[model samples]
Target: MNSNRVRAVLVAVTAVASVLGAPDQATAEPAARGGTQWKCGFYPTPGDPQGTTARYFHCAYNHIMIRVHWSNGASHLGCIEPWENHPFWRDGGNVVVNAYFVPVTPRVLIAPSGRRVCAASQPTG
Candidate 1:
């Protein structure tokens, strides 16, 4: 019985490790135009009473499209249509930016541009 238990535990540990260590699989090549993709989670703003952070996945090429999935059963679909018009892009020219969600806030900030940053803290009523 002890040997069986040990073997079961080893199998479980190996399965967990494999799942955590596996790399994301994407059909499109990373270098292909409009094919770059990143998956990241946003954290809640600091000092917020409610500890809720929005999670998002972003895909970009000519523009940025973010799918924000909130913990409160709500979601937001946003896009930086004029990403090139942003001052940060002025220097970089047409560029795709990656953004991570801030904790307790519903804001997304440009990872490179560092401009037009907005924070949406959990609503207090």
Candidate 2:
């Protein structure tokens, strides 16, 4: 409980923190925009009169798999193969492979580095 002991403890903590190289999010630079962005598209299903049943999002990265969180409350840790367009879907949406049908597109997306993208180009229907 002495002044010297308190000083020594504070110094040790500072040293450990410096050695660990803790990052400060407030001062951290935002992640650069890159290929992790999703490209959404619609495809027709076989024997369907409407011809616009399939809906999906494709994302690709050159080096590593990127984890993304969709605005529709879906979090995915996929997109593995490098430079390949991996398909992802929104939560509670329907696909042609099944019986039920519910199509919805996410308007916002978040990446691992705290980078976010608002998909204004996506259809609002």
Candidate 3:
């Protein structure tokens, strides 16, 4: 290829890149602290969760679901309780929830259920 042709190709590539924003891992996800940074990418899949209404963010976590983590690698039945005090809100050692359950409720279940959160959601598990 001639010098001008090569230059033109390079310019086109740059233009395309500018049009499509680059991936930002740092701001995309949070880290464990002192540990390596969390991998970049959408932890949970995109799209609105079921039962999400125009008042979504205002009302979160309609139902109560508990996720138990076992040191020996086993799943436990959920514990029910008021928000914030529930075990489902926090993370445990050696085990982690498939996704972070976002439980927020201004009042009762008359509104939409809360959304389940994630880190970087890929097509395949």
Candidate 4:
């Protein structure tokens, strides 16, 4: 897709996820065997030359889409490749950004507990 279109999609998905709120834990799909889990934290947005951090960050389990919510009542939908342990995509200024999937090595086995999505993101700066 064109850059503008892609950005619009991102913004729309993020907005929708934010408005809909967190997924039901009882309904959340079980984490796949050997799913890659990245350490949750505040990381730079895609294509950010200045390494601008988002309000919250976390990769989805397997290929399932996840909603990572922010403190300011915003959220974004993103997912990570279950097969890869390293960063998945690079910033082409549209689709993906620097270390967008797994900015660092996989550490935690599960996302932090919360009624909210990607709760209490730790700063990785």
Kindly report which residue stretches of model 3 are placed more than 4 angstroms away from their true locations once superposed.
Answer: 1-61, 87-125
Q: Model 2: per-residue lDDT, tens digit, 1-125?
A: 33243235434643453345434222322233254332333233444343444333333322222333334333332222222222323224533332111244334334345533322222322
Q: By summed lDDT, which 10 consecutive residues of candidate 4 come out lowest?
A: 116-125
Error of 3 at 93 (Å): 11
**Candidate 1 or 2, higher TM-score?**
2
lDDT per residue as tens, model 1, 20-111? 54222222333442542223233333333433222233332233434433233333333322222111111122222333333232333332
Q: Which of candidates 1 and 4 reaches a greater TM-score?
A: 4
Instruction: Tell me the spans in candidate 4 whose CA falls farther than 4 Å from its real position.
Output: 22-125
Instruction: Report lDDT per candidate.
Output: 0.30, 0.33, 0.27, 0.36
lDDT of 3 by residue, 1-125 (tens): 33243235434543443345423212322321236322321132223253211110111223333333333354432212222222112122332223223333212221122322221111111
Which ranking of candidates, highest TM-score first? 4, 2, 1, 3
Arrange candidates by lDDT, highest first: which order? Answer: 4, 2, 1, 3
User: Which one is best on TM-score?
Assistant: 4
Per the 3 Å backbone cut-off, how many clashing residue pairs does candidate 1 have? 7
Give the per-residue Cα lDDT of candidate 1 at 4.
38
TM-score of each: 0.22, 0.23, 0.21, 0.26
Better of 3 and 4 by lDDT: 4
- Poorly placed runs, candidate 1 (over 4 Å): 1-41, 48-62, 81-125
Give the total clashing residue pairs for model 2. 0
On lDDT, the candidate that comes out on top is: 4
Q: Give the winner by TM-score: 1 or 3.
A: 1
